[model samples]
Target: MRRPVTRRVLAALAATATGAAICVAVTTPQASAAVGSATGFATRNGGTTGGAGGQTVRATTGTQIHAALCNRASSSTPIIIQVEGTINHGNTTRVSGSSCNTAADVIELKQISNVTILGVGNGALFDQIGIHIREASNIIIQNVTVRNVKKSGSPISNGGDAIGMEANVRNVWVDHVTLEASGGESEGFDGLFDMKNNTQYVTLSYSILRNSGRGGLIGSSESDLSNDFVTFHHNLYENLDSRVPLLRGGTAHIYNNHYVNIRESGINSRAGGRAKVDNNYFRNSKDVLGTFYTNQAGYWQVSGNTFDNVTWSSRSSDNNPAGPNPTSNTSISIPYPYSLDAASCVPNIVSQTAGANKGIRTSNGSCATQNPTSGPTPGPTGNPTPTPSQPSGTNLSIGAGSDGSSKASGTSYGDVRDGNMSTAWSPSGATGQISIKWDTATRVSRINIREASGSVGNVRAWRVLNHDTGAVLATGSSAGVITFTATSLRKITFEITSSSGTPRVAEFETYAS
Candidate 1:
């Protein structure tokens, strides 16, 4: 029924609450990289150069996409198939002379290599369809959304994930895309992205993953440790249960991501996975980064990470938090050169660049353009002034704040507006007060706070007070996106009168508009 890659992916997470389900079925570009390069394998591969020295064909239907792959001249011919509309698998056709029939399930690229699947126009979508890449190499997938691919019990038709890879898969770059399902197994969905069995040199950039029980995972077992040299950056992971993603044995470079409302956990590095966790904003999540709940202890070099209201577990038999409270790790070198966007800029950058339909957003470091291979991107729309998405005012409270009654190293009060959300100032208690005062009188209108994880999060009763005058400039229980009149002021403080529980305010941001 289902292929080797699909079955292997499903087998990895078919039991966990947020585990991946069987795919119904599905599935990159080519880089013109030399056999080996310093750019790292994943960054060096993708679509712009996929069809080079070959054909650049445009396909508007599922059958056309299948035809482009099936009719290719060997695995190295280099074909870039441009997809321009929603390709629904329900109406797919059979691939001639191959058991890889699409009418039943997925668009299989069993042995295809040197191909780039580029989505074009308003945006291309693979709806209720999946793409499988196995025994393939040198691929790129960009500017597309893969969603609602249902799972099937019929082994052949259960295409599996939004994207699945295994067995000698290599050198792929997936950028500016959205992959999701309504829920986990019960909803017939699987991993948004997955890799197994010697798969290596992959980069997932500027992508949006949301509303799923499981995000993604690397190896299938503690013994399957060959997966390595992967990079995940500037991706937005929101409303997930866990594994944004669960690393195992690979050497992964993770940075500048906005992880929001990870209902269960985030970045569960295990099985000796060496992760360089740097400059990420982890809000409303538990154990954001560390050797997580597993008997096999993974190592991490975590720095410049803003951990808001995140929880830490004890060093139990199978659950290790890996901290000063757990264990320390040495920093590893990332194969490619990358610029660290301040953790504070994570939300702004990820929200704007991630997911499909984003018009030609700037690439990350040396990474290439992720826009579709179609017409030029449309210009800005109606609004022109300062907006919430793009705050136009100065954060006067920068480097100015205290934990009021309690403070700790790396969690000091001054971390609030240091232009890094990865580091926060958590006070002593839920009912405590953390305030900001200016030596000189300053005017302000907007304030935003990113809460910590777990039940203690969700500030319910809070008040912003003028410290110098003891006058209330603005007061409310709301923590995120709080705005008031631009008033001539000297000081501001947030008092937690009541909350959903303890208020772990990770970021206390103020802006004048």
Candidate 2:
């Protein structure tokens, strides 16, 4: 929603050009002149030039200044555009000229690649993005400050993107850039760049983005699932109203970044096919990170990430009943929120299960019930068998049996652990045999199951019930241990039942391959 500054208005300003002429002229210094011809621009303190195409034209406005550079010859030859002083436009101020037409904007990158638009030592500021890229690639926009971009049309429109990159650009590098937005109703859109569609191999690093809407840094997919391969690292994000950093889709690597004072989530990965996230820091945020609602089974490796004062939540649309669970396994090793100091720093491991339960456990107790006969039962065609009901606080132990020999029980389907615990089948009311179907072929060897209870009738019998064929695997009574081996299916469930009187089981622990 950025307004275009027309060439006709610049032509009018050129006609009234007066004062010191701050023309963008390239000059080689004596030292560098001997080494090579250095490229740059020379301009007066505060003045304007006219004309739109010539290398030496004057215009009274920043828009005109930008137009002059756009009209330069040789797209491969880098042009040096300089800002004389500050150009004020209402509440907005710019280092160079502002405004662009569709034709004029496209002309800026007609055939350019290695272009470097350096800012003045004091840097430049604009109400909107300083430069917007379209159908351009291998570009580097560095050492610049872009601030206070106006929202597009309204709150709903796509506006205030600091640098908008569209139309299949590639191999771009944005470094050492600073973007700040005034925190109000006018939220900043994309910070360094807003990319979509077939844009690949881009890198955004060593930048500071603060107070942006939607995302501080974003890579999006507009329908066809753009194959974006972006890398974001060593950046600092502060006061982002929404998700500070995000990977919308494709392959992305996010690492070593710091997020502070975030409102919603620190980092969000939505609809992305595959991503690798590691070694990042999230401080004082509502939820530290999230991955949700991907059409395909998305794969994410979250490792060695640190979170202080962070909250976590998860919800998914996949009708698996077990919920969309993310695995940290052994690679996630960040400290919990309650253990960190005000400014503590901790290392993030790649495969540690530190925050695995942050999104899964809503409340502390189990929601299991025992129905003797009457209850809403599942349809015969797709329903699992009925499991037994047990009370709470049941204690079951596992060790060498009365004969001082180990007994084997339970079955493993695919790679998943099902029906290994005494209470697993009780909550689901699955009676009879318990079967497992693995999504893929898997090899599992060892298994362990334990039930904990206080009194005699408080202990119930437990067994593995396969929902597929309605068959029970290993059955046991009272509080005891069971061990066995079996292959696991991709998806399966466990079944439990009362052996004698209804027993109270406090915990059901299972260890399996």
User: For this target, which candidate reaches the highest TM-score against the unseen true structure?
Assistant: 1
TM-score of candidate 1 on Cα atoms, chains taken together:
0.64
Question: Deviation in angstroms for 497 in model 1?
Answer: 30
**Each prediction's TM-score against the native?**
0.64, 0.48
Q: Count the backbone clashes (under 3 Å) in each candidate.
A: 31, 65
Task: Give the residue spans of candidate 1 off by over 4 A.
Answer: 1-41, 44-49, 97-104, 153-159, 323-328, 363-513
The candidate that achieves the highest lDDT relative to the unseen native structure = 1
Put down candidate 2 lDDT per residue, 1-513, tens digits, no spaces. Answer: 423323321222211123333333443211110101111010111111111112223232354444544444434333334332333343121222222222322113323443444334333444343356666555554445666655543322124566666666655655445666666344434454566655666666545676665454345542546756666655556677664555566665666566666775555555544456666666666655555334433345676666655655555563111112334422322211111111112111100001110110011112221221211111112212222232222121222111101111332221122223333322222222233343454333222332322122222345654434445545443232333445453323334454322222333333333
Task: Give the residue spans of candidate 2 off by over 4 A.
Answer: 1-22, 29-61, 80-111, 153-158, 184-192, 216-224, 293-297, 318-513
- Cα RMSD of all models vs. native, in order, equals 12.9, 26.0
Per-residue lDDT of model 1, residues 332-434, tens digit only:
8875667787676565556446666655354354322233234323222221111124346677677665546575444777766676756666655656678
